[model samples]
Target: MTPKQRRLARRLRQLRVNSGTSLEAAANHLGCKQPKITKIEVCQLGARPDEVRMLCELYGAGRATVESMVTLARTAKTRGWYQVYDESANPENIDFVELETDAVAVSNFEIDLIPGLLQTEDYARAVFKAGLPDISADIIDQRVELRIARRQRVLDGDLSVWAVVTEAALIRAVGGRDVHLAQLTRLLEVATLPNVQFQIIPTRAGEYMAMGVPFWCFRFDDNYGTVALDHLSGTTFLEEEGDVERYRLAFQHLCSTALSKQDSLALLRKYIKEEHSEWERRS
Candidate 1:
């Protein structure tokens, strides 16, 4: 479920609890089955706007809260922009996009490559090519475009981001010297955004808590949050409080071990200059 849907579900459950409305009672009041109520409250099913209104009214929710929840329900039912690309795309990837769209804050830790949100066009293409070499060119292009579109969150200044990347990711040279130079320069530009913070875990910071793990933690308006862990098969989205807390604590440790934002920028600049000199030498 998307963050908005989760928030709506949480709100509905909270209102029902506060009003002491049993699931059976709530379902009877709404002319629905008890399982349907359970589904809506757990975000396994999307609630219609009218359903939200009726539930809020039944739970004695205030007018402002009812309207807010109704709006949330409508949003939860709406399809995200990423859905326009291809319905056949991986469902987990689509879910991540939806979560990212609704997130107010994001924390990312990358080990092997730059985070997709920070990747430049050429750099993204190279990464996609390496991962999906057997795929058709058209599909690869589509994936690259989708990745570029994800950067809208940063460009639109709607989301606050804290990204920590390993030094190896910065110096990997994914698309050769030219692409690496552009990527480094792009990172420098992206880091200047008011809501973006970039840090680097030095190569020397060995034996860390998240050595091989690359994950992202998204924070919504409420205290609710989700974590996405990358694996060989696919991504894993963790919503359990215990799982989220562990990832959050891991991220905190990463932040402390990583170089400061200013120092990271300096490192980026140093690499950028070195890459430029190498390109000049080759030419």
Candidate 2:
């Protein structure tokens, strides 16, 4: 289940508890089996919009909360846009995308490459090629398209993003000089968006916390959030309170140590100029 669905399940369970309604009572009120209520509460089953509305009425929930639950129910039943690439995409990756789509805010710390939501098409293609050298070209193309499609979230102005990227990520030429320069230019363009922010962690900031791996923290309107850790083998989603808090603090530290937004933009421009000079020399 996506984080949104899990959050909705938690809310449903909490509402029942607050109203002193037993599982049997809720099931009876909804005219469903007890196991059905349990499944819905645990996110094993999706609740219908009408069912959510009825439960809210039964629990005497406020208008805002009721509407929110109904919206979550509807969203839970809908398929994610990433489903189109289901054959090529990992299930966990699809789940992460679903959570990202519903997130109100996202915080990412990248050590190796730019986050998928911020990467340019060429840079993304290069990363995919390097990471999955054994994979078929057709599969890589599908992944690249999926990565590019994720950028629409920012373009639509529905999500706010704050990214802390390492200096090495900027310095490394993922798709040769011209492509790398273009990628930097793209970063500068997106950084100007009202909802997007970037911080560059210089090579000088050595031996810092969160240097071991890249991770993304997502925040929702319901105050529940999750952390996704990128590993060589696969991505791991962390939802435990302690794990999430640790990553959150690590991200905070990275932001504090990294360059300010203005300085980060300046740094990107510097890289672009250097790359352009190198490209000119080679040409």
Q: Which candidate ranks first by TM-score, i.e. highest?
A: 2
Candidate 1 per-residue lDDT over residues 10-111, each given as its tens digit: 779978988999999999999988999999888899889999899999999888878877887888866678987764357777888888887889999999
lDDT string, candidate 2, 1-283, tens digits: 6666777887788789889999999999999899999999888998889999999889988888788789988887566677898999888878888888878999999886877889998899999999889999999999999888889989778899999999998888889987888888998899889999999999987878877678999987766678998777888888755677788899999999999999999998998888888889999
Error of 2 at 26 (Å): 6.3
Off by over 4 Å in 2: 1-4, 14-39, 54-62, 279-283
Consecutive 10-residue window with the lowest summed lDDT within model 1: 84-93
**Clashing residue pairs, backbone N/CA/C < 3 A, model 2:** none
Using alpha carbons, what is the TM-score of model 2? 0.85
Question: Which portions of model 1 show Cα errors greater than 4 Å?
Answer: 1-34, 42-45, 50-68, 278-283
Error of 1 at 65 (Å): 7.0
Q: How close is candidate 1 to the true structure, as a TM-score?
A: 0.85
